[model samples]
Each structure stands twice: as C-alpha cells, then as structure tokens.
Target chain A: MDLQVAIDRVTLDKAIDLAKQLDTQVDVIEFGTSLIKDYGLEQIHAQLPKLQHAKLLLDLKTIDEGEYEFDKGFATGDILTAMGAASADTLTKVYALSQSRGKQLFIDMMEITADKTAQIVNHPAAIYGIHHAKDSKAGFDAAATVAAFHEDYPMVQHISVAGGIDLTMAQKLATQGIAESVIVGSAIVKTADPVAAAQKFMEVMHK
Target chain B: MDLQVAIDRVTLDKAIDLAKQLDTQVDVIEFGTSLIKDYGLEQIHAQLPKLQHAKLLLDLKTIDEGEYEFDKGFATGDILTAMGAASADTLTKVYALSQSRGKQLFIDMMEITADKTAQIVNHPAAIYGIHHAKDSKAGFDAAATVAAFHEDYPMVQHISVAGGIDLTMAQKLATQGIAESVIVGSAIVKTADPVAAAQKFMEVMHK
Candidate 1:
C-alpha cells in the first residue's frame, strides 16, 4: 500500500513547506480540495515545484467543464480527482484526458449510490474511491463502507477510501485486503506532528 | 426572469472589461469557471470592482469541501455554483453558507441522472440548472431537457438552462415557460460581437 498524505485547510506557504518535508517519504502528496479551490490551480502551478520526490494529487472534484479543469489540473500535478457522481460524459472525458497525458484519475465517490456506481464501474484505469462526506451528519464506518462497496462492484479493481480514517482504521483496511489507497486528511495534517503521524500511519498500513 | 451574462475563457483584463460593460445591461454578471481557475479567485477578487448595478456570480463549480469553497467563493461574488452531482452534504453545506451570506446558489445539473435529481430536489432556495455537457457525444436539446426535468421535479421552483443556446433556442425556452434562466456561453462570448449577441438573446428570451 502506498502512503498518500493529504494536506488541506492551510495557507499555501505552510502546505508547500509540509509537502516539501514529506515528499521524500510519502508516495503521493495530495493538495486537498481546500487548497485547489482556496488558492486556485494557477497559484498551485506556480508554487508546486517543492514536490520533487512525491507525486502531487490535486483534489479538483470537478463535475463539469471536464476538459478545461482536467487540462489545467494536469498542468499543475501528476494526478487529479473528479466526483464519480459527475456526468458519465464528464467522467469519461476526464479519464480519457488523464490517460492521454499518462497521469492518474481518482474517482471520488462521496455520495453516489450503488446504481450509479454500476454505470461508471467500467473505468478499468481510474481509481474508484469510497469516501465519506466531510460534512456528513450521518455515521461513517469506513471499513464497513469499503466492504459493502467491494461486494457490490467487485469489478472496480482500483479502490480508495477516505473519511475518518486513523492508523487503527487504516490497519484494519489493509488487513481487509480491498482498498489500494486510504486517504486521511485532518487525522494526519491537523496533528501536532504530521510527519510522525504519517510515519505511524505508514507503519500501521504497511503491517 | 433575470439575464446573467457569463464571461469565460478570456484574459482577466478582458473579462473585467466585459464585466464592466455588461454590468449595466445584465441582472447578473458571471465570471465563469474558466476565469476562476485561470486567474484564481484571489486575483479576480483583486480585479473585480463592487458592481453598482449587477450582481456578480462566480462559477466556482465546487464539487467537494463545500464550506471552504463557498466561503472563498462568496468573498468574491454574490452567487456561486455547486454541482447537483456533489454529495448531499456538499450541496447542503454550500446552500447553508449561501443562505447565511444572503446570496444565491446555482446547482448545476449537467450530467446527473433523474434518480440523482430526486435526491437533491428539496432545496427550495437553490436554482436547479438543467445543463448538457459541452463534451457530450450526442446532441443536447436544452428545452426538452428542462421541460422533462421540470415535469419530474416540480418541487424545484427555480430552474436554469445552459448548453449551446442560440437566440432561437432562447426564444423557444422562453415560450416553453419553465426555465427561469438560459445560460448562453460560447454562443455569446465567442461571437464577433458579444454585447450585440447578448442583447439579441435577451430580446428573443424576453419578447
């Protein structure tokens, strides 16, 4: 399992500093949706040279104007994310664009239903994410959500999960043997020691 | 019925100039998603003067991290767009933020299915937009899409439409009497004369 450290809700200078610090250790460095929308992709493109060793993933969460967003997003990073609930056409267009650029697309499934997933499950190359909403009023059993999603759409080979994942939960996911990537945001970045937190997560996930 | 002239895919200087010119004629002056991503919201916030007559609508096209995006978005414009395809939590969070700001939220329904629409049809304050993707392989009949969507989700009071609308289609949507707004993008902005094109569309839709 590759460790993807997601940085969010911080100033660009702070985010860049943390990214530079973690680049050599983490496999993927994600500029969370907050960074992209707050600072904009143009600024990120200007300031992202710090990510020399790790792959940068911008959580674009694009739904429409796929070509425009994906084209600009790819200019700034190695990977971009789109809402799986985006139009079939939008998802397909971005996926194709990512493929053409030899980059990666992470399909963020924040609130999409099982039926909708069936429609978009054919993207053999894209990563289908089982994400719990950040602002959800409901409960998020990340491990259970992954198990249900896997049972429903087993063909969706490259799966990822995010939302309320701690090192314990991350380890549980690893032992479950489904999700290829696990995304933890505040649990890591908001900590007193983000690098130490990430190292602990990496140890648990790798175990 | 209000007219919103959206300026997109132009240099920030040109967009600002157009917004200034169109501010007097239109009810809303929109900086489309292109401008936001290209120039970044911070830059646009610096360039955008407080509109004396028109309400500024920045098409943020936010798909996740609703609170952060809406917060940043409202700092610049009177209205911001979130995809109907985004999680209910996302839509709800942005809607609340918009409500608190005493601004508007335009929910773009570009590629969402009917079932998805059922899930998001409860926000009476949001303007439900019926849109066809620019990257769609098949032809999009905008009036037809709006009429069908209105019939299905009559609870959704305000409706908006976008996708290759010409002056003729604008008149047709006006006569159809469902969509409260028709979003004309490249058809107006890419024309040899944008102001003339916008006036012609306004005349056709309003007459």
Candidate 2:
C-alpha cells in the first residue's frame, strides 16, 4: 500500500514546508480539505511549487459545480476529490472531465450510504476514497472499515482508505491487500518531524 | 417571503460590488459556494465590508470539519450553510456552534434522500434549503418542489428553496406560503442591472 500523508489545518507556508519535506518519503501528498477551502485552488496554485517525487491530491470535497471546481483544481494538483453524496450527474461529469484531462478524480465516500455507494461505483478509473468524517467523535477502525467496504464492492478497483490511520492499521491494511493507498493526517503531519514520521509509516507498510 | 440573492462565479471585486448594491434591496445577500471556494472565507472576511441592511449567508456547503468551517464562516456571514448529507454528528456539532454564536445555519438539502431528510429535520432554527444541483441538467420547478418538501416534512420550518428561480416561479413560491425564502442566482446577478433585477424579484414576491 502507498502512504498518502495529508497536511491539514496549518498555514500555507507550513503546509508547503511539510509537503516538500515529505514528498520523497510518501507516495502521495494530500493538501487536505482545510487547506483547499482555507487558501483556495488559485492561491495554492500560485504559491505551491511542483513536487518532484510524490503525487498531489487536493481534498476539494466538491458536492456541486463539479466542472468548475475540477477545472480550477486540475491546474495545481494531480488528483481532485468530489463528494460521493453528490448527484450522479455531478459525479459522471467530473469523472469524465478527469478522464478527458488525463488527471484522476478521487470520489470521497464520506457519510454515503451503502445503497448510494453501490450506484456510484461505475467509475472504473476513479479512486473510491472511504473517508471518515474528521469532526465525528465516534471511533474509527480503518482496517475493518476497508474490509467491509471491499467485501461489499469488490469491483471498485482503486480503493483508498483515510481517517485516523496509524502505523499498525496501515500495516494491517497493506497486508490485507484491499486498499491501494492509506491516507494518514495528524499521525504524520503533526509529528515533530513529518518526514521521519512518514518514513516510519512507509517502512511499516512496505515490510 | 424573503428574497435571497446569490452571487456566484464572479471575481471577488464583482461579488463585493454586487453585494454592496444589493445589500438593501434583498432580505439576504448570499455569497455562493463559488465565492467561498474561489476567494476563501478569510480573504472574503478581510475584504468584504459589513452589510448595512441584508443578512450575509456564505454557502460554505461544509460536509465535514464543522466547527472549524463554522468558526471562520460565522466571523463574516450571519448565516453559513452545511450539506444536509453530512454525518449526523457533523450536523449536530455545527448546529450547536451556530446556536452558541447566535448565528444561523442553512442546511443545503441537495441530493439528500427522503429518509435522510427525515432524520435531520430537528433543527428548528436552521433553514432547510431545498436546493437542486446545478450540475444536473434536470429541469426544476421551484414552487412545486418546495410544496412537496413541505408536505413531506411539515415539522421542518424556515424552508428556503433554490435552483433556476425566475420571476413567475418566485411569485408562485411566495403565494404558496410554504417556503419563507427563494434563492435567485443568474436570474438576478447575470442581468444587465443586478440591483434592478433584484427589485423586480422583490416586487413579484410581494405582489
């Protein structure tokens, strides 16, 4: 499994610094929804330097105006996310746009019901992100969540699991072979040395 | 009935100019989701002058990170919107935050199923906005939609309807007396004179 380190709720300068430091250590560097909504795609595009090693993902969490958000988001990041709860038309439009532009769309599956999930699983190329809401006080079991989701929809090829992913859970997910990528936020970014933290997670996943 | 004018897909300068002009004419001046994502709440907060007459509503469409988004959103806008499809926990957290601050929360009920709607209809102070996804090519009948919604969820007060609301539709909604507010976007803002168009909408609603 690939380690996707998410940088969130931090200043742009700090986010850029962390991204630069963790670029080589992780497979994908996500500028979290907080970063995108706080600074915007235009400002982020203007400020953030191009990454040399890792892929860039911006958690746009787009629910409506899919084309407009995706059009601007693609200018900066390699992958942009849209909410799975969005209408089929919105999802279809953005997925097609991603394909046409040779970029990727990550469908953020947060608070989406199983019935809704089953219907929107037709995007073969799009990454189906099983996200846990950050604001929820409830406990999240990343591995079990991924396991259940995979069992429910084995057809979804590019699966990614996010929210409260620690080293142990990361290793378990990597071993399970369901999710292609595991997204780590505070565990990696909030550490004393994000680069070192990311390396450790990567080490565990690879081992 | 209240007229909520939505300013979207424009430069920040244009948005501010339009907001300034429409401040007194409309009951509420909405800086749509486009404005918040394009310019950001912080930048908007710093730039936008306090509205002298109309209440400000920023369509944050916040799906997660409720407290963080609401804290920043309430700094500038009298009302902030959250997606109705968000987790129940997220909705509760933001609702409490809004209540604590004595501001309002507008729940954008776009693509939310009837079952989900029944679950989240408890926030009496929160305006339940019956929104049609702009990305969808499906035609919308604003008054009919609001009436149907009201019939289904009679307990839900402070209903706000949006999506392709023209003069006739606005008049019909006003007469129906179910929706307290009708949100008009391009019908007003895309006109030669936005302020004049807003007056025409207000006239129709009042008549």
Candidate 3:
C-alpha cells in the first residue's frame, strides 16, 4: 500500500519544506485544499520544484469547471481531485482530460451517497477516495469503511482512504489489502518529526 | 435586485482593473473560483486594495474545513462561499463563523436536489445561489430556475442566480422579484467595455 501524506493549513514556505522532507519518504505528497486556496496554485506551482520520487497530488476538490481546473492543475500536480457530489458531466470531462494528459484523477467521495457512487464508479482509471468529512462528528473505522465499500462496489479498481488515519489504522488497511493507498494528514505532517513519523508509518505498512 | 459581476479566467491584473472600474457600477464584485485557484487568496489579498464601494465575494467553493477557509477567506472578502452539497456540519460551522464575523456566506446550490435543499435551507441569513455547473451542456433558464426554487423553498429568503445570465434574463429575474441578486460572468467581463456591460446589466436589473 502507498502512503500519501497530506500537508495543510500551513504557510507556503513550511508546506514546501515539509514536502521536500517527505518527498522520498512517501509515495504521494498531497498539497491540501487549504494550501491551494491560501497560497493559490500559481504561487505553489512557481515555487514547487519537481519531486524526484513522490507523485504530487493537489486536493483541488474541483466541484465545477473541471476542464479549466484540471488543465491548470496538471501543470503542477501529477494527480488532481474533483468532488464526487459534482455533476456527472463535470466528472466525465475531468476524467477524459486526465486520461488525455496521462495524469491521475481522484474522486473525493465525501458526503456522497451509495446511489451516487454507483453512478460514477464506471471510471476504472480513476481513484475513488473514501473518507469521512472533516466536519462530521461521527466515528470512522477506515478499514471497515474500505471493506464495506469494496463489498458494495467490487468493480472499483483503485481505492484510497483517509480521515484521522494513524499508524495502527494504516497497518490494518495494509493487512486488509483492499485500499491502494492511505492518506495520513496530521499524523505525519503535524508531528514533531514528519520525516521520522512517515518512516515509522512506512515500516508498519510494509511489515 | 443586485448585479454581481463575476470576473473569472483572467489575469490578476485585469481582474483587479475590472473590479476597480465596476466597484461603483455593480453591487458586488466576484473573484471567481478560477481566479482563486489560479492566483490564490494570498496573492489576490496582497495585490487587492479594498474596493471603495462594492463588496468582494471570493468563490472559495469550500466543501470541508469550513472554519479555516472562512477565517482566511473573510480577511480579504466581505462574502465567501461554501458548497451546499457539503455535509450539514460544514454548512453549520461556516454559517456560524460568517455570522460571528459579521460577514456573509453564499451557498453554491449547483447540482443539489430539492430533498437535500430542504435540509440546508434553514439558514435564513445565507444567500442560496442557484446555478448549473459550468461543465453541464444543458441550457439553463436562470429566472425560471429561481422562480421554481423560491416556490419550493419559501423559507429561503435571500436568493442569487447565475449560469449564462444575459441582459434579458437579468431583466426577467429583476422583474420576478424573487432573486436578491443575479450573477453575470462572460457577458459582462468578456465585452470590450466591462464597465459599460456591467452598467447595462445594472440598468436592466434596476429598471
């Protein structure tokens, strides 16, 4: 399983420093939506040097104007995200664009129902991200959620799970082996030593 | 009725120039989602001298992390937007934050159903923005949509409409007296004289 580290709610300089430190430690480095909205993509793109190992994913969470956002987003990020709650037309356009550009598209399945998920699950190349909303007060069992999702939509090829993910949950997900990747935000990025925290996560996932 | 001139997919320089010119001509000046994604809020806030007359609305299109986005967004904008499709928790937090700060919140009702709308329509102070997704190829009748929305949700007091709005539609919406504001994008901003185009919209809306 791949480890995706999400960096959010920090200054651009700190985000860049964190990304550089974790570049070799993780499979994917996510510049969360807060970073994008706070710093803007132009500044982020101008300042970001290409990573030698990790793929860059910008959590654009694009709900509309998929083509425009994806086009610009692909310039800096290897993968970009759109909201699963967005229109089918929007998802289709972004998916097509991503395929054309040989990039990846992550569909953020936050606040979407199973019925809506069925409608959008046909995109085999797209990664379906399952996570609880940051604002939701509900408890989340990442492994259980992944298991249920896989059972419901067995056809979904690539699955990613997030939301308060820690080392234990990461190992559980790795053992379950249903999720292609696990997204760790504060667990890794907000730690005393992000690089060491990421290395620890890597050790557990691979153990 | 109010006229909101949506400045999108343009350079930051041109957007600022157009906003300054239309500050007195229009009721609101919108920095569209494209601009936010392209230039970012930090750059936009740094370069923008506050508008002397018109209110500035940043289309943050926030789906989660409501408090954080609203906190940062309210610094440079009098109004910031959140997705109606987001979880109720997100909507509640952002609405509360907006109220506490004495700022405004616009809920983007793009692609939401009446059932979901019923759940989120309780925020009386919030502006319920009705529009079609930019990616959808289907035609949109802005006045009719607003009229239907108003009929369906009489409790929703403040209404705003967008998507392919022109002079005729603006006049119709104004005459209907249902929508509090009509948002005009390319029709006003793409013309040879954005100020004149905005003036034309203002005349029709106020006529």
- DockQ agreement of candidate 2 with the native complex: 0.66
lDDT of 1 by residue, A83-190 (tens): 877878889999999999999999987777777778898889998877744445454577778888889898888888887887888898889888888887788788
Taking the candidates in order, what DockQ does each have? 0.55, 0.66, 0.85
Could you give the CAPRI-style class of model 1? medium
For residues B60-116, write the lDDT of model 3, one tens digit per residue: 999999999999999899999999999988999999999999999999988777778
- Candidate 3 yields a Cα-based lDDT of 0.91
True contacts kept of 3: 0.86
What ranges in model 1 sit over 4 Å off? A132-141, B132-141
- Summing lDDT over every window of 10 consecutive residues in candidate 1 chain B, give the lowest-scoring window: B131-140
lDDT of 2 by residue, A150-197 (tens): 889989999998877788888988998989999898998888988788
Question: lDDT tens digits, residues A1-207, model 3?
Answer: 999999999999999999999999999999999999988899999998999999999999999989999999999999999999999899999999999999999999988877788999989999999983344445547788899899999999999999888888889999999999999999888889999999999999999
Enumerate residue pairs that collide in model 2: none
lDDT of 3 at B90: 95
In candidate 2, which residue ranges exceed 4 Å CA deviation? Answer: A132-140, B132-140
